[model samples]
Target: MPASKGSRNAVSSAVQQIVLSPSDADYLDQLIPAIKDAAHSNRTAQLLQGLSQFADNHESEIEGVCNTNHQEFVNSVNQLLQVREGTVRLTSEILDLNQSIQASTEKLAEHKKALVDSRSVRQNIDEAAQALEDCLEVLRLTNHVHDLLATKNHYAALRALDELQNVHLREVPQYKIAEMIQKSVPAIQKLIAEAVMTDLKTWLFRIRETSQFLGEVAFYHTELRRTRQKERAEKDPFFRNFKLNSAMDLVSDETDEFDVLDNDEVQVDFSPLFECLHIHEALGESEKFRAEYAATRRQQKDLLLPTSIRLVGDDEGGSLSALLESIAGFAIVERATMKKAFNLRSTVDVDELWDSMCQSAINLITQSLPDIDDADALLKIKGVIALFIQTMENWGYSVAALDSFLLTLFDKYAELLKQKFSRDFLEIVSADDYMPMPIQTSEEYEKVVNVSWYTPEKEQSDISFPCVLPFSQMYPLCCIDIRNFLNQFYFFSDDHFQHPSVIDETLKKSLDELLAQKVCRLLVDRLSSQYLGQIVQILINLEHFETACVELEQLLLAARSPASAGKSVALNATEEFRSNKKTAEKRIFELVNSKIDDLIETAEYDWMAPAAQTEPSNYIQTLTRYLSNIMSSVLLGLPTEIKELIYFDALSHAATMILALPLSADVPTINRNGVAALALDVQHLSQFVDSLGVPILRENLDELQQTVNLLQSDNSDEYYDVSTRNKKYGRVDPMNGPLLLEKLTQGMQSSGRTDKYTTLSSRFGKK
Candidate 1:
């Protein structure tokens, strides 16, 4: 069949398109499949066209597969041939080796069996040697335990037994070694316990010996005598008539003396108990020893005093005193021993010991307070507390526990004393006195004053003075009572009046405040029942108020710390009284100044009055006398500034009067000379006003001198000018006018000329 031209052309174009564009070739590839189907059904010549289009679409893919697959197949066939040849040669060698292995199989099996048999024998030998070594170690430990027991070293024997217990002997069940160890442990522990018991007995015997030695010391003889004498004095009615020294007495002021005792030559030996206590601690049986020691002390005390009545019975007094002395000696020695152990045992708890000691002391004091018949029991308790504190210091502890306990005890005891004895003290201080009552005058200007004996009084009877005891005696007694209260537990001596180191600073301040409150109470009770003026008068009878201040200051210095002495509330109150009087003086100056012009205008005669007139009309003299009271007892011992201000105030008043005097018609020279004299008196007073002191006072003095000079000047009109341009224009305004500078500055400011005077001084150049 010949192809049509159109079909041939289509085939050529399709081929070109497929070659130019692969996407178009993909489209032709799809169309070629369908075209082939159509050509196969319709025209076979078109199949060739479809075939050519399909070939064009997949030409590169077909060439790549042919090229890659052909080379890969050829290389794989060559490798397979080589591998097949090697396998044939290896098969021949493997068959030959198999024949050789089959020939030697029986010999190799015998060699393996021989090696296994030798390894088993070596393992057995090692097991036997280890067993033998373990058996020897067990036997050695057993022998060591036996040896230690024979030597009576119980602790070492116990340690050996403990070591043997660690052995894990798991031999045959019939073996007796483990059973024997289990059975021997109880017997060994028993032996060690018996040995410890025997050691404890030996130490106890030594402690008894040490206590006996302490009991034989000579220091107790003086203590016994003192106790007996105190007992007798308390019982005797004649002794009761006189006041006994308090339990806390340092010394008696009435005696103005103190007795001294020589140092004792004998001392107790405490070393044996010290050693015993250490041994007990090491044995872990300190509590047991302490219990036993307390029992022994009780037994000895019971044997010494069989009955309670024997304590005071004269027939058995000597025995009772000896028992007390013995008990005291035992306590001291025991404390010393405990102190030694406390110092040595750094790990021992000190709080426990301190609590025990403090509780015991507190119990003793609390139980003994109700039965305080004499100083004997109190003295014993005091000695115990002091010795305990001393031991704490010796043992190198803080000792704050014992100190705090004593403070608590002292507070209760002081309260007891205050309740029982304060009333009697008050009774003694409330005695009646003959001090006259102050009289008030009808005149408004007169200060209230005491009546003169020369005047015939409408009421002849005198008002009773409020206080009974003089402060001179009262202060000393109060101090004594305070000393007795404070020293009971504090151990203050005559030579050492300072607070003991055992009392903290805060506690000391508390005690001082308490005493101050008591003394102030006494002062209030005695002095407050009267008028203030009368109280001052009463104080005047006893001593000068300044003297009282001095005495109080001294008492405070002796009683407490110097830092607090001056600042005490009581002393500050006294200072407040002085301050109040100073304020009153200032108010009185103001009062006198208010009436100065009126007093000057009404005077009929010369300002100076005759000396014979006890009550004068001269207001200046009255003011002078009133002010003199400020320098006298009212403000005595006050600060110097106060006094300076007082004098300056008087100077200012006199200067004001001199400057404010109007031009009077009658007795012009009299008025001028009188004012001049007043100014001269103020100038004389300026000598006492300390020119180099406070600036305000010095300035006042300078003002007063200028006023005095002007009043006495020949040309007074020159200074009287008020013009701003005048040379003498700056004088203080006369007749209560405003200051000259104030006047001139105000006038200039009103005229809007303030800047005119800004440089006035530089322009004028002092005129």
Candidate 2:
């Protein structure tokens, strides 16, 4: 196989030489193995082996190039060593140069230190020299300022001293100069204070010498501002800050020596000057105002007093209404003037002026009251004072003084009234023609007892009762006076007079006492005598006694009632008047009762006449008629209980008269049935009066019934029989038990048939 491969290789080589020839012998030898290897079945391994041989050749060429490079690296190392040698030399040269520079720097610093020390020494010398010069200047200025102050050139001295202080050389020299200024300040201050004082005094003198009232000072000060504005019209007037104590300009110069040194501006107080500057002109003006006000008050008083009184009474005498109107008008003017003069115009703070003025007003009214002396002047005076008091109260001032004066006036007026009314009462009492008794005839008596007075069968004359004075005439005058008093002092009638704190109750008591003691007593004393007896007889005859009682009661009550009742004296006066009333009432009742008893005792019945005459016995009819007249007239306005008691007494007396007188010959003969019938009429009359619903009337009615019942049961002299037990028990008759029950039954039955309240029987228990 090798021989064939080698022949192939040679052939291929010859071909290859023609295609790609190999130049070396080894190359050919190597190519032949590669050809053989390629021709073999294992050509890959052969190709690899050829590549490895090529790599080895390449590695050999690389190693040869690396050797040439190693020689160049040696040359470079040598050059670097040469450069290192140059750097070392240069570093040495630099270090030697650094050492030389360091030596020079030390030398420069030493020179700078020396120069700085020399400069510091020169600055020190210059500062020391300037300070010495400043000290010299301070001493010179101090001496100069002291000299200026010695000459009292305060403004110049102050300037120089300020300049000295500004130097501030040393505290000692400055303090020494301040001491000199301090010592000189007192004299400088005195001169400046004198100048300021002169200016202030000039201003004050100008103000005080102004010819004006002190009250015009505020206005004058206003004028000062106007004058200043006009005087400096060309310039804007500097409005000074109006501090209350803006006198600082004057005060600052008036300083003590120590005060000057302690502060730049010494403070001085000018309050003493203000206090010393008192205006005597104000005192004079006040006195003048007082005199003027006093004169004005005098003129007002004159016009108010007699002029007011003249207005009250005309030349003939003014009417009450006109007098009051004038007094009130005067009071109004006085009040207004007093307030305006005292409160507004007068400068006096003293109350004496006002007090006197108030007193004058009161005095004017009081004095005017007594100035009236006419017959009716007293009444007019009272009216005037009342109007004056009312007017003053309406004016709303202090009324204590006026009220006090009024009390005295009222007392005096009351005393005067006592005299006037007493004299008037006495004059009328002595006059016989005032009230005369009328003559009463049998026909008049017959008419009175017949109960037919509305149309009397017999014509009767005018029947007049005797009176101390006709109440119709005199009493109206009293009413007029009372009405006048009340209307005049209307304020007193209000709630104000009731409280003792407001009005003097003692004065009220005295006034009431005067009326009770004088006026009321006059009426009572005059009315309670024979004249009263005559009046009572006439009233009883005409059955008007109850009317008299009520009139007297009203009069007594008015006398007892006073304006104020809180005082003990007023209470005592009321008690006295009440006692007088009771006495008068008792006397009046006694007189009327005596007359009634006489009529009852004299009553007689003419039973022997015809049946018509017997039907109403002359005695019984007369009694009943009289009683009817009595009830109709006297019991007109009496209280129900009083009327019942009166009627009971009249009926009881009639029963007593009938029971006491038997059916004897002295009386006209009458049958037992007639007596029984009379008894029935008596019972009926008793029942009629008993219907007034007074519990007391029931007992009297029951007694009357029993008396009539006995007269009917026993037609004998025992008609008024009193059982021993009943008499001892104060019961005069047996009770008419069945009769009363029968009457009550009839009353009830009749009441059911009639209106309950309107029925007579119903009036019994319902009332």
Candidate 3:
């Protein structure tokens, strides 16, 4: 656009000031759009006029700006010229580089082709080398496994076989040697397993034999240890004063006894067992191995139990103690073997194998129980079992099953003992002769006093030899039987009953009941109603039996365990004996009364005839002689008080018999002479009663004498006087005097003594 000089200069100055370099071209181009917009809108003149006014208004500022930017514009033109030169140079270099790159690419492709061909050969060589190495490794491992198997190193062979199959064989899958090794792997594994199982079987056999040897060794050591402990305890002062918690504590505290046998001589090899375990574990049959091991041991343990228990005295290991020791020794060895070899803490880990073993033993012992008849043998078995229980409990095994078995054994033993005692007592009593045991010599007396049940109240020196030996001195054969039975019983009980498991009180009670029922009561039932002399002897025997029983009761009480200290078991035999004694005494009196009745029945009186003699009747003489013989001989062993009682009672009964003779229905009437004979018999009876030295015996005899005296009187006035006077007939009723007078009158009339009878009747009847 044409403009003024100042405007043209402003425009030039603005152009120069804002020189459009390549970076400013965008700014100039941006302004071209606005300039074109103005031109197209027909605002070009107006735009020229606005620019002229802007150039005139700030001319100095625009010149200063131009002048300030003049050198910069010049530097810009030079830089642009330099840039153009550099651009031409760079374009030529780029063309040259592109041609070189194309040539290098073709050459690189040729070299790559050759390198690929060589790499293929190298890769093949590396693969062959790796395959060879793998084949060698598999062959080496296979040979090594065979060598291990040959050397019986089954566990190592199995491990090497694993490496060959899982790692080395994977490397050489197509190789013949690898294929052969792979095919043989199963056979090798099977061979290893079979070899391990064979070794295990051999180990089982060796263990079985070794267990027996070890059991015997253990038993020997246990016995030796017990002997040593006993010797030590005997020497120790404190042991005498103090008791251990249990006798089992002594054995239990010395667990080191097994250590003494852990030397080469006694130690068993466990290499085979460990190999079996490892090989089985590797073969994925660990559980099967455990089951097989357990089953084999269980079968072996079963074999340890006897089919039947041997009798105690039959053979070397026949005794209950020996058999139990053998069993216990085996159990101990087995327990230790399991704990050490298998790393098991207890038999509990193997499903309580030890308890199962004990059960087998218990069953065997129980099955043999019926054949054991001896109470002592049963007791020995029971003691052995109790000790076994204690030993097992100390070894950390459950004894509940064993404890139940022991209780059952105890019950059986108790019943057996009771039956034995009962049979013995019955036999002794049944065969006993009802006679005083003859102790004629001092030696015999000493033997009697020395019996176990004969605990004398006084010293032997102080005791005198009685005419008849007391029951304490075994006066009867049954007493000796009692002594023997008690001796045997206490011998069995002393050690057995002291054990905590036994109920001593119950056993003692059973014994008491047995003695009462089988001995004392038996004696009473069999002897109380026998003859008087036998009854007398039984009474004496019963007295001694009571004394013996009292002593036995004391012994039982003293031997009782402390747990039953509050309980008391009084022997019923003592009371039964005492009662039997009383029964015998009464029975003796009854027998005497019966004899008197028989004698009285044999007496015959002639009431209507004249008196034959002035002496006593034959019956009275026989009665007195019989009584004298009994008092002097049969009742001689009886105490003086009892003898006197029997004498007085017999005499009084005789007097009663004589008094009843005249009133008997067989005597229709008594003549004066016959009455005189009867009065004479009464007088003889009174004399005999007076001689007995018992005033009570004389009373009945005196009454009989007074009645006979009244009948013997010739005067009717005397009969009237005796009947009216209370002093004359103090033992007789005064009101019966008329009846007595009338009977006398009738006798007189019957005998033709009418004068005397009429006077007696006239005098007493009217009164």
- lDDT comparing candidate 1 with the true structure: 0.45
Best by lDDT: 3
* True-structure Cα RMSD, model 3: 16.6
- Cα deviation of 90, candidate 3, in Å: 51
Error of 3 at 75 (Å): 70
TM-score of each: 0.31, 0.32, 0.69
Candidate order (TM-score): 3, 2, 1
lDDT of each: 0.45, 0.43, 0.66
* Model with the higher lDDT, candidate 1 or 3: 3
Candidate 2 segments whose C-alpha is farther than 4 A from its true place:
1-407, 417-479, 490-507, 518-523, 526-588, 603-617, 656-698, 701-730, 733-767
Which pairs, if any, clash in model 2? 314-318, 604-619, 605-619
Candidate 3 wrongly placed segments (more than 4 Å): 1-138, 155-194, 210-248, 251-267, 278-288, 302-330, 341-351, 383-387, 452-506, 525-531, 602-604, 608-612, 671-676, 692-742, 752-767
RMSD of each candidate relative to the true structure: 40.2, 36.3, 16.6
lDDT, candidate 1, 335-403, per-residue tens: 555555564322233344434434544554455456443333434444444443442343344557556
Ranked by lDDT, top first: 3, 1, 2
